[model samples]
Target: RSPSYLAAQGCWPGRRLQGSPALSPFLSKCGTFPPESCFFSLICSLGSFMVMLVGLLRYAHVIECCGPSLLNTLGLAAGWICAAGLTMVGNFQVDYAKVLHYIGAGVAFPTSMLFVFLQSVLTYRMAKTRGHYWTGHLRSILSALAFITLVFSGVFFVQESFVLQHVAALCEWIFIINVLVFYGTFTFEFGAISTDTFLVLLKASQAPKSYKSDSSTASTPHGHSHSEGLAMV
Candidate 1:
């Protein structure tokens, strides 16, 4: 509807209709108008917040289960950066803020690809159960598809042909969908998370160094016994 509304006002490229062959509209372009732009901005902002929260939870989850690793840290950074880019994309309309919008797009797309790839690698590394293995395999496929689509979208976007541009737009949509689905996959692991997981992290962070060392010395034998019981469970 926004596309058609833009078309009616000659806001679209070549003043073409929504499905016309002249120029396939970018998602940003569809939200360039008044009412739709407001909704677009709101949705993007909310999405960015959700992405950031999810990234933090994932980082904390990894720290809790597998201990800290460089890959997990890097993935969190990439996810947060991508979220920042999304905020910029939503607030800056391409028509009015072309440079800022493109900059945001530039930041968002590559970082999102990196984030998914890193998470996929981490998933494989952390795989213990059959379900974890299957999750890794699914993430790997989605990461590959996302990277391919992102590359094609970028390459075709600069082409002179409208048909190519339409293809590029299609690829862009696919890339976004793939990324969203990748985020959705986190539910598999998140399901097993409990409040104790975060509480342990908080306590570990707040505990004094002297107390930690003393506790480690005192509990070494008991810790081993507890770990074995946990593993068996």
Candidate 2:
């Protein structure tokens, strides 16, 4: 399996997200074979919310380091809004809070699509500036796949046929899967930096160790620390 596939080890599949009667009136949320599958809605929603949080945190770190301008700031804000919207959707199920559920979906889906595009641009810029060719190419490809799938998802949203609904459901899943894949690619970016070591250092002083480490260890601007040995695997 691909690394991205492995990263989404426990996420719910595409079919789980297509249960609501409002979206697919013909299909039953509860399947006869398994019996009462409607609860998959909760699974899909919560899983998506968690995945979105990963995107928010990783991209925010990248922006903070590489994106210092007004545009990057706005992009980060949009990313946060997108994450919030996903959380809202998870909390407000369609059966309980129809208005709130749709509202959350409205905010989450579009913002997610927008965030991918913005991240793509950011990646392209970083590739040129920092000479990260493979990362940029991979992100660009994932962004394009996400946009295409999301577009199909939107186009099939208003269709009445079950066939169209099935296609739309698949498209939505592909879109989300691509988003998760893009987030997984951040491992490459993360590998380039010592953020993990710094994070350990930030808390290292609180730990039992009080002494500064030797020169062989990782070196900070101020000095060297034992945490430097903890490389960004």
Candidate 3:
């Protein structure tokens, strides 16, 4: 399943329902809803961390393929921060530690956005260098959309009106969707990596010399060859 699907699973039927308040219903209160919201929180943490880790691992290929660049490094750093932030968010429940929750969220959200932007830039650069369209142009379009939605989300969040706040919430979800879709663009690259890795592992596991012959003769305590039949005489 897509990482986004995994993430949505963490929060579905719990909060942020259709035609609801601007803020996540859980965020509106001190504790989680249905008293089991922490479970979802944990899910979010795990899913988010997994997604970010995959993205980070993808960076090794990026670095190898694209060579070292400041943008790539920045994107990797941002991804690490995003993953750590997600872990923190999961570990610290909002109701239990509001300060810590906000801190974690603060780290996660902006860095997540930053990761998106840096990755988009890097992808665009790589596409241009390789003369590829999908990674460069298509990904650029998705990144642009994500950036726009994120801007709307941030803008609406600062507004005083409930309707605007709700709109902001909706935009936030849209931004997330864009980010998820953007990540999906890497499917081809990931598949290629998996295939190559599998082939390399298969080759490494197969031994050319299946069997070996003893190069030296074995001798018995009587100074006779063990492999030779003993003389009847």
| Candidate 1 residue-wise lDDT, 141-161, digit = tens | 999999999999999999988
Off by over 4 Å in 2: 1-67, 128-131, 193-233
lDDT of 3 by residue, 91-158 (tens): 67776787887798788778878887787777766664454556777777877787787788778888
Give the least accurate 10-residue stretch of model 1, judged by summed lDDT.
15-24
**Global lDDT of each candidate:** 0.88, 0.62, 0.66
Distance from true position, residue 160, model 1, in Å? 1.4
Quote each prediction's TM-score. Answer: 0.80, 0.60, 0.64
lDDT tens readout by residue for model 2, 1-233 = 23356336532333222332322321222221222333544555665666556554555555546644455555666767776777666566566676886787788888877776777777766665555776788788988888898889779978976678778778877887888787787776666555654454345334444344543244564343335545533
Query: In candidate 3, which residue pairs clash?
Result: none
RMSD of each: 9.9, 14.3, 12.5
Which numbered prediction scores highest in TM-score against the true structure?
A: 1
Please list the residue runs of candidate 3 whose C-alpha ends up more than 4 Å from where it truly belongs after superposition: 1-31, 34-36, 128-131, 194-233
RMSD of 1: 9.9
Residue 48 CA error for candidate 1 (Å)? Answer: 0.3
Stretches of model 1 off by over 4 angstroms after superposition? 2-23, 203-233
